[model samples]
Target: MSSPRFAVAQLDEITPTPCPCGQARRAFKEPWNTLATVHLTDIHADSKAHYHQKMTEIYIVLEGEGHLEADGQIIPLKPMTTVMIRPGCVHRAVGKLKIINVPMPPFDPADEFEV
Candidate 1:
């Protein structure tokens, strides 16, 4: 027998964890999988700026109005806005927001650094 070619995640059943942005519900994560993982993050008003060493992240805003602070540059954002953050770029989302984040190479806590 062969393993299933796909995996499914019930995000609501997942526990939320404190992250730099706010709280996050990470799904579709596996140690053997090195491609990517997805997270549902709630952006807090005081989201902290951070960066990843090698992982690339794509942020898709699902709700709220705000801006993306990337290396001191402010990029306005709204619902449905998408931004691709590359490795080593310090970034953070401002204001109240709900977003879906896709992290390439999966999300590694050890790779995240506060800026």
Candidate 2:
């Protein structure tokens, strides 16, 4: 057997998992790729404020309008809006939204901290 150099993930085929946000379909979560990971997130009105100690996340809004609360600052969000969140920045999405999240250095559950 040979190791594959590339991987593919179908967004719709991926199961949505519960997170601080509403639900998320994550791709490239395997240990083979530690540089980055991608997620399709459906944000809920009650998304909790949280931060990552090691990962930096880039969020690109895909649907609906909302606001991104970062470090107590409210930033409006809309379709195509993009936000880059650094480590330790307390943040959460308010209102219903769909976004594509790209996490650098990958995402680790242990690094997630509630604010």
Candidate 3:
């Protein structure tokens, strides 16, 4: 019999993004259409406001405090807080924030939409 397509793991794999702010991805390719465990570290809100064309995302605070602006509303966030971002939703996090970002369809820089 063939082994399962996916293997067990103690920790997920992480890939870094090319932005002024720090961005890392934790997800697998192919068959699986969803992406997960993106870490956004020490970045300004304006630096992260770019949108994704084929993906939706959620941001959960791991450390520090900040504000999330989504759909024209400002929502205050602290440790353990989470915010859901729909595809094409204009959103950004303010202040020095460390967050866990999860995106569906994975994140492709070519698919990003800039405001």
Candidate 4:
């Protein structure tokens, strides 16, 4: 038998975890597959400002309205709005939103820093 070259994850089956932005269900989080990870996040009102040193996060708003505060700038957001946040940029989402976030180089719990 040959080993599968790709990995599959059921996003709905993945458990949601508390994150800086809200609750998130992440997929493709294996250490060996470190290229990227996909996250479905439900943004709450109390999202915190945080930065990642080695990961670049791309956020795509799937529902609701909001604004992204990134490096002292506020960017308005709505459904279909996309924002790419680079390493070292302190950012957070305000307002109710459901977003799909893709973290390049994958996401590391240790790399997240609160600012």
Candidate 5:
């Protein structure tokens, strides 16, 4: 067996679509324990404010700027910045922000965190 190199996946390759909360997500990730990415476009803070189980999230800003309301505090995230969200945390992304989401436990459609 052999290991493969990890390269930065271009944001242009992901087509944004409406998530369950009406936000757009461009999913990009290898089918392994390396990394998982979800590009979020035009996100609102309310999106992350909700709660999820068995999933820890890290939102990296690819473009634009916005305010993130997590842990009952308001934090501003600009380009080249990252925000970490632990599992079972109520959070959301707000404004015209493009975010690259990395999930440690990966994403399972059936295990999606809902309020």
Candidate 6:
């Protein structure tokens, strides 16, 4: 048997970075893990609509109420609301919200696109 290949991340301890959604703390961004990447996103009123070329994202709302605009369609968001956004879909969060975003194949800045 081989050693366990895994990692643990403390979301709150990670420094938040500026994102279109306000702020985000991304984890597992290393190339070693190509499976997925997790992000703690703080959504603000100024969040902008954007898309990913080759990444799929799963968002789990954690706090606050809001609406997710995807491909021009708005969907209500609340605590425990989960949304799966595929590649090429333009989406953004309206209102103040905190969500957990998981991106498949990890997150690559090069894959993010603004429409």
Arranged by lDDT with the best first, the candidates are 4, 2, 1, 6, 5, 3
- Give each model's clash number: 0, 0, 0, 0, 10, 0
lDDT of 5 at 58: 80
Q: How accurate is candidate 3 locally (lDDT)?
A: 0.65
RMSD of 2: 1.4
RMSD of each candidate? Answer: 1.6, 1.4, 3.6, 1.9, 3.3, 2.1
Tell me the tens digit of each residue's lDDT in model 2 across 3-112. Answer: 46898999878999988988999999887786888999999776989999899999999999989999989999999999999998999999999999999988788988
Q: Is candidate 4 or candidate 6 better by lDDT?
A: 4
lDDT of 1 by residue, 4-87 (tens): 579999876789999999999999777667789999998878688899999999999999999999988999989999999999
**TM match of model 1 to true structure:** 0.93
Better of 2 and 5 by lDDT: 2
Model 5: lDDT equals: 0.66
Off by over 4 Å in 5: 1-10, 20-35, 38-48
Among these predictions, the greatest lDDT belongs to 4
Count clashing residue pairs in model 4.
0
Q: Give the distance in Å from residue 95's predicted Cα in candidate 5 to where it truly belongs.
A: 1.2
Candidate 6 residue-wise lDDT, 1-115, digit = tens: 4433988999988999998889999998776787998999998785878999899999999999989999999999999999999999999889899999999989888888877
Error of 1 at 5 (Å): 1.0
C-alpha root-mean-square deviation, candidate 1: 1.6
Residue 111 accuracy (lDDT) in model 2: 89
lDDT of candidates 1 onward, in order: 0.91, 0.91, 0.65, 0.92, 0.66, 0.90
Model 4 scores a C-alpha lDDT of 0.92
Of candidates 6 and 3, the better by TM-score: 6
